[model samples]
Target: MLYRYGSLIHRRARLVLVIAVLLIAGAAVAGAGVFGRLQGGGFDDPGSESSKAQRLIDERFGGRANLVLLAHATGGSVDAPDAAAAGRDLAAALQREPGVRDVVSYWSAGVPDLRSADGADAIVLAHVDGDATQRRERAGQLIERYAADGPALHVRAGGETAVNLDVNGQVARSLAIAEAIAVPLTLLLLILVFGSVVSALLPLAIGGIAIAGTFAELTALGAVTDVSVFAINLTTALGLGLGIDYALLMVTRFREELGEDRPVAEALATTVATAGRTILFAAGTVATALTALLVFPLYFLRSFAYAGIGVVVIAALGALVVAPALLAVLGRRVNAWPVGRRRASRSAGTAFWARLAGAVMRRPALAALPVVLGLLVVASPLRHVAFGTPDEGVLRPGSAGRQVADRLATGFPSNQNASVDIVLTGPVDRDRLAAYAQQLSTLDDAALVTSSAGTFGHGTRAGEGNPALSRPTGERLTVASRLTAKSDAAQRLVRSIRSAPAPAEAYVGGVDAALIDTTHAIGARLPLGIAIVVLATFVLLFLFTGSVIQPLRALVLNVLGLSAIMGALVWIFQDGHLASWLRFTPRPMDTAMTVLMFVIVFGLSMDYEVFIIGRIAELHGQGMPTDEAVRTGLGRTGRIVSAAAALLAVSFFAFGTGTVSFLQMFGIGCGLAIVVDATLIRGVLVPAILRGLGRLNWYSPAPLRRLHATVALREA
Candidate 1:
């Protein structure tokens, strides 16, 4: 199949190139509007009870406050005439804002929960009415207009909309900075690796097509469904990285074929036939791994699936169709413009990787034992892994939302800003509702519980609460915890609230509730997600290699490499190692980001794994011994793998410059994973393991062998 495709490219190279150009041009034009179409947050499970609770609140009550304005008396008590006047003025202005409603503040209701313990700072709660995109836009506008130090009240913004806005904004800026650092460095490194200016340009062109095409896909998907804007970062990073990966393989083989003195047409056809098959298989593996994200309900993970599959498929197409055409056209000039030397990939059997493989094969057990133990130790931090959703704390210390969140944590007696909201859906019994509120009030961390009946303090009815809690069909209850919402205590309190007997059909939601629901949602599907990735990857590798043992070997090493990366992330990001240098708060890893990083690293590690194993498989099929095939394959392909991994690592590493902690963790983790995979896993473990397995590496049952011979994906 690939041979025919390659033959067509050889015959109609110009036509293919022209078509690719037209498509890329069309993609760029359509993709320009993607940012506007994309949204800020899809971290919540839309079908979860917390989500239903939020929707019920919006439909019945005005809606739980999705916006918070933390106000401080500049020089005196908030109840002072001047400070009280300024607080009321601020609330009135917010009440009149176009997207704002349900303005509740200390001065407006004289609510003790709205005022800080010290009586010097207070909070204003308002519901921002919109979808994620609209809410963020509205919040940005409102914060810009109202969140500043005034004559009497100094206000800062922190809430769902504000935190999402801050995260999305930081991601955009981080991507820009990452690109600024990565692109030039990648180009220069490509030139050095390719040893020619002309060869280096092909990968960039392919990357461009992948990115533009995926952006166009995102634009279309965004218009109809929920798509996170964060996917843009993945589109850019993975698109370029995969482009370089595929192009490096194809161009290296093309040059190797041409160096055999074959004509351009024959060489191009062979390169396409071999490398094209490899590219397709690699894309399938990556797309399969990324497809595991589809099982997740959160559009944050699903959006990455959309972008990842798009980029991988498009990159593969670019490599198979566009790269071959370009290689055919350029032919001898593909190796043109040598920088300092005309050095290209050599078939010399004495390369450093070849010697390393030889040494390892001589003592596979000795080489394998220590590296295994080291990765296991590094991955020991896995036991301490914990997860939470992204919050304002993801931003740097001085970020506006973080400032508000910090004050909410320390300045207030209890953070009313992080209330656990419950909504009754059926006809309400005021008696049962009051009883429920009293029950909620007794929760270990509950500070206050407000409902239509009244406010409960320590299981006792205090006084009349916000009148807004009452509605015709149902009632709304807000429970404020003394502990911060991200805390274990807060999670426990939320769980207790949900378990407590309710007056009617109740849905519990808020920061703490949403966190519990999100954790549960992701946790429930996590085993299935892992199963899909693992089972599919195992099958794909089996089909490619026609050997069960090979797939098992791949899985073990891939896990080892990824385990170390995860441990490093937990240690550095979660445990606060190097927190000062990175300028990010130490907290639990973002559940969604951690999953995204795992699949990305897993897919990409398999990408290199397939390359190395494919080369060895080919050499062994040519009648070489296992040890000779391993040495020769590593010698031939090591430089390309190193170069590609370095460029890819640099691409991800640049994101470490961001102010957002999760993204920074993601950047550092991915870069570290690549370096470790390339050097340690690919460099040391693979060779040692292969040596240990020997002929067992290619073993398959007779029936399966026959099946593979009939339908297997062919080696390059």
Candidate 2:
């Protein structure tokens, strides 16, 4: 396979180069027109409990989803006529702004009920179209324009739209900070591994091209749909990860041949045939894992699924196709600045992996027990993991969004600006509805209740069952109530409300309720996604390795790594341990994080599976004894695995510097898992199992044995 493909590619180098270039160009052209307004179907407008509360108001009052709440007080008497006059002026100016569909201050018609009895503090709510980004910019302009007015009103914006905008800003800046660190560090690591500056740069170049192409595509897609900023960061990270990984595999193979004294063209051909083929399988596995996310009901998960697929495919193309062409052209120049080259006479087959495998074989049970126990210990924290939506605290505590959120929580219901809506039927008068609303308000969990008559206090909205509810029109009445807390508390409140005996023929739905439903929906579906990835991985690996047991072994080890990592994240973030030291606040993991973790861990685990299995398979194909093959294979691949793991770990570690809680958790979890998987599971336990199983490692039923001979992988 190697000689034939290498000869063909070398003979048609020009044609291969031309074809690769054209493919890349075509992808780039197709991706170029994607802009913010023309986004792909994957992007969605980020919705939260706060946004849902605002939506309740929109549905009830015919207003917009965006709101702007202003705090007004003069130096001395806030109740003075002048102060009130100034507040009204500020409100009027806001109402005049473009896209300001409507605005209501204390003076607005039918709004005096919102004012404090003493009139010392007041707020203005505005309705607007578009996303939080546009609305937030408008809010800032409003604040800046109103801050210097007479008597100096302290105007601060607090609402779902505003907070969403603020969070978006923080996320964007944090990604910039992370990229600034990870990209350069990745390049440096690649350079160090490859020896020459040029060789090291190959990964960066390919990754950069792939990312550029993806972003351009995303931009065009954004024009027609919403694209979360987080997707951008995710795409970049994945592209870099896979690009460097593929380049490393190919370069390592190329160096091995050079050491064997093969001609440059022959070495390039062999590297492409062997390493290139392995990359394809590795990429196939990763893409398969990522594609599983599409099965998730949420649009957010599907978007990332596509993003992951795109990045992995592009990286594989760079490695399997472009890399060989470049090597063919460069020839001996590829080693012009060889840095980590081992002496030609000393084979990687002589590395410490053989000794480690021997030790593991001698104590298979003991060796496997400790790694499993260690992972279990690390995984203990996962039991304490609590799920919640991302909050303002996920951003820097000092950020505008954080400040505003704090103010709302402290001065109003803990779940102020967040509510659940219930629509009831039958002939109910204002008094009955008011009594019902009041009853809801008095519930231990309710915060501030209100209705058509007036607000109970903060976030509680009293229901106004006017003649509308009894009329033949069958008017829809929405009951809104804010909880005293976010996350679990809010979810509980929604559950209690749903379970309560309300009027007959009533339907309940709000942001909190929706989130609760979403959470449950995703949680229920997780097992399905896991089963798909695990089952498919087994079938694929079973076929690839011709071993019935190896695939199961891989699945068990990967699960151990994942569980251990999740537990550590739970202890570190959910429990708030070491959060201060890391300059972050611990918050519950959101649905998105859980889904993402499953996908990323599965894909990453496959990289190790293929690398280790490829080496073992190669030795077996050469007719080596099972024990000798396992030992030699471990020895040959250990350093490369270690190096690759280290590079990925460092890159992930860089993300810990981010302010976002999920990103920080991701950084630590992935970094720690990679270390454990590379050093312990792969290095120690895999060898033990292979040794204990002996010939079973290569065993396949007669029916499948033929398939292995034909479709089974040949070593790259």
Candidate with top TM-score is 1
Tens digits of lDDT, candidate 1, 1-716: 67777878989999998988999999999999998889887889999999998888888787778788988898768998999999899999999988789998899988777788888889998999988788888999999999898888888888878888888888889999999999899999888777789999999888888999999999999999989998998998899899888998999899889989999988988888777877878898999999999999999999999999999999999999899999989989998888865453343322878988889889888988999999999999989899999888889989878888888887787786577888887667777888888988988888888988889989998888667888887788988866876798888888888888887888898877888889899999999999999999998888888899988898988888899889989999999998999888899989999999999999999998888888888889889999999998888777778888998899899999988888888889989999999888888899998888889989999999998899986753
**Index of the highest-lDDT prediction:** 1
Q: Candidate 1, TM-score vs. the true structure?
A: 0.98
Q: How well is each residue in 1-716 modelled by candidate 2, as lDDT tens digits?
A: 75577667766777788887787777677665443332212222235333343444455444433565656576553446776777777778877888776677765543443444455556677776555346556656655565343554676665656666665565667677878888888877776666677677766767766676676666665666555556665677777777778877887788788878999888888888777777877888888888778766666676677677778888887776677777777776776765665343135434667788888888999998988898899899877677765656677677655665565554442334555565554445555656565556655566554444344533344333333223331223333344433557767777766676654455555556666756766777788888889877877787667877788888888888888888888888888888888877777776677778777877888887888788788788889988888888888777778777877777677778887777777777777877888889888989888888887777778888887778875664
Error of 2 at 689 (Å): 1.9
The residue ranges of model 1 lying beyond 4 angstroms of the native Cα positions read: 344-350
Model 1 deviation from native, Cα RMSD in Å: 1.5
